[model samples]
Structures are given as structure tokens and as C-alpha cells.
Target: MTNVLVLGANGKIAKLATAQLLANPDNHLTLFLRNSKRLANAASDRVKVVEGDAASEADLKAVMADADIVYANLAGSIEAEAKAVVAAMDASGLKRLIWISTLGIYDEVPGNFGKWNHQMLDGGYLETYGAAAKTIEDSDLDYTIIRPAWLSNNDEVAYETTQKGEAFKGTEVSRKSIAALVAKLVADPSQAIHESLGVNKPNTDGDKPAWY
Candidate 1:
């Protein structure tokens, strides 16, 4: 049985991912969140809840103890928190990491959509996420960076995943799909290890629903 620690465990998609993780009889899941109260009643023998800020070194170290893999789902200031997570993982000697990032951090979103993403959500903050990704990528640890296009609340499972160069195509994808992707990463990370992968819902017209 693999013990997996999930950071940002209370987010919408994270919650779904948590469900999938819990469904796995062979996995021990830990839900690390700043406010455990926000999490609906989803805890059991296989699922444990730990309350603490992911950015706090002590808390991260404490929660990461004895874990085989760590799946990061924390949102907001992700770059900084990612750095902290790297440090904590390094300290704990847990070399497996599956991180979630934005699709266009590489500036590869394409055409007007890319321009708008850069103008609106991209901003200068992306440098931080990129740097954070670089830190994990360069480390001796095995890491898989999963970047998602746009997030939505739709309940669907059909979606596509790409490597570094492939375009994300769609404007938005369901959070549930992203969650399923995370669960897959947790299950079979070796295939994507030490690689960066992109994900999105393949669209017919190429023009998709606004992520906003």
C-alpha cells in the first residue's frame, strides 16, 4: 500500500480526487488543508485529515512524514507554496512529486486565447510558478508536472492529456476531469515521471467555454 499525502486537500477538485483516492483500497490518503473544517465529512481509516498551512515548513514536514508520494493541489500563490513543498519533500527524502500547474506557464496557449490568458491570468506571477517547476524538475527527485488548461465545475470525464509542446486546445475543462487525472498520476506516476504533461478537454470548434 502506498501512502500519499495530498496538499490543498479541500479544494473542489481536490475533494473529488480525494474521493477517488479513498476508493482505492491499496492507498493511504492524507488530506492536508489550512482549514480542515471546509472539507465535507470525508474521512475514514484509509483517509486521514491534517490541518495546517502547506507553506509552513514545520507543518509540511510533519504532515509529509512517512509518506511515499505527495500530490500537490493547493491553489493561490502556488509558486511559493510549491517551493516550500519541494523543500519539505527534500527534507523528508520523499522523491516522488505530482504537481498541478497552469497550462500556459510555458506561453504556449496559442493565438488570441494565449494572448488573453497572458493578459488576464498569466501576468508576471507565472515566473514564480515556472521557477518553482524548475526547482522540482532539476532536483534528483522524480517529479511529474501536470498543467491543466482552464478549470470548471462541469461533471464530465472525457478529456485529453499532452506533453510539453502539444496545445491544450480547449478554453476550459471540468475540475472533475482534472481530479481524475490527479488520481491517475498518483496511481501510475512512473510513466510521467520526470516529465511535464498538459491536459484539456478536446473541443470540436477549438473555441471553448470561457474559463471565467
Candidate 2:
């Protein structure tokens, strides 16, 4: 059985991934978030919901004992959380990690869109996120950093990926697509190990997302 620990379980993509992971009877899940009450109704024989702070190494270590994989969907103080996660994983001897990040952390977005992306994200968001991604990349743990394009609530799963050094593709991708990618990784942990993927919907390339 694969024991998956989901940090920031209340996030939209994490919730979707949780349902998809649960569809496979052999996969068990530990939903970790700041307030367990938010997921009070999510507990079951195969699901364990725990309250904890992602930035607290002790909190993370407490839940890492049985986890085969760690999927962190977090925001705010992300660098601190990344350090804490790496430390906890190292201490637990757990290796697999799936981290949800944003596009342009590498400044790899190209053309006018790249400029626009920097203009929009440069102030503080990209800096902190970049530091967080760096923290994960520098760790010894096997990790896949997912860099998603502009997100939408679209109810579709059409998306593609670009490697770390490759220019990011398209403009936007649905949250469902990101969730699907996460589920795929959980189902087959061998794929994208130690890789950073830039996810976007095919044929949607532009200076901005269609809705903008």
C-alpha cells in the first residue's frame, strides 16, 4: 500500500488530488493541514486527517513515519516550509516529494509573456517562491517541482509540460489538470524524479491567459 501525506490539504488542487488518490483502493492518505477541523469530514479507515504547521519540522516529522510520499501544496513562508519538509523527510528516510510551484521561477517564460509574467510576479511573490524552489532543489530528497502556468477554474484536464531549462509553454492550465498530474505522479512515482515541470494547456500560448 502507498501511504501518501498531503500538506496543505485544504487547497483546491490538493482536495482534487486527494479524491483521485483515494480512487485506488491500495493508496492510503494522511491529510495534514493547520486545522484538522477543515477536513473533519474527510477521515476514514484509509484516510487520516491531522492538524499541523508545515513550517514546523517537529509537526512534519510526527506525521512522516508512515508516509511513502509527501505532496506539499503550500503558500506563504514557502521557503521556511521547504526547509522544514526537507529536514523532516531526511530524518524520516522518506525520499519521494511532489511540490506545487508556479511558472517563471527560473525566469524561463519567453517573449512578451515572459515580460508580463515578470512584471506581474517580480515584486515579492516570485522571489520567495524561487527561494523555496531552490531549497527543494538543493535537498537530497527525490522531488518533482510542478510549475503551473496561470491557473483557471476550468473543468478540463488538457495540459502539457516543459522541462526546467525549456521555455514555458502556453498561457494557462486548469487546476484540474494540475491535480491530474499530481495523481499520475502518485500512481507512478518513478516518473519526473528530480525534475521541475512547467505545466500548461497546449495551444493556449499568448501574452496572457485567454480570460485576461
lDDT (tens digit, per residue) of candidate 2 on 67-121: 9999999988899999999999999999999999999999999999999999999
- lDDT string for model 1 (14-100, tens) is 888888877788989888998887764767778888899887877999988879989888777766687788888889988998888
Clashing residue pairs, candidate 1?
none
- Model 1 poorest 10 in a row by lDDT: 203-212
Clashes of 1: 0
* Positional deviation of residue 184's Cα in model 1 after best superposition, in angstroms: 1.3
lDDT of 1: 0.80
> Per-prediction TM-score, please?
0.91, 0.99
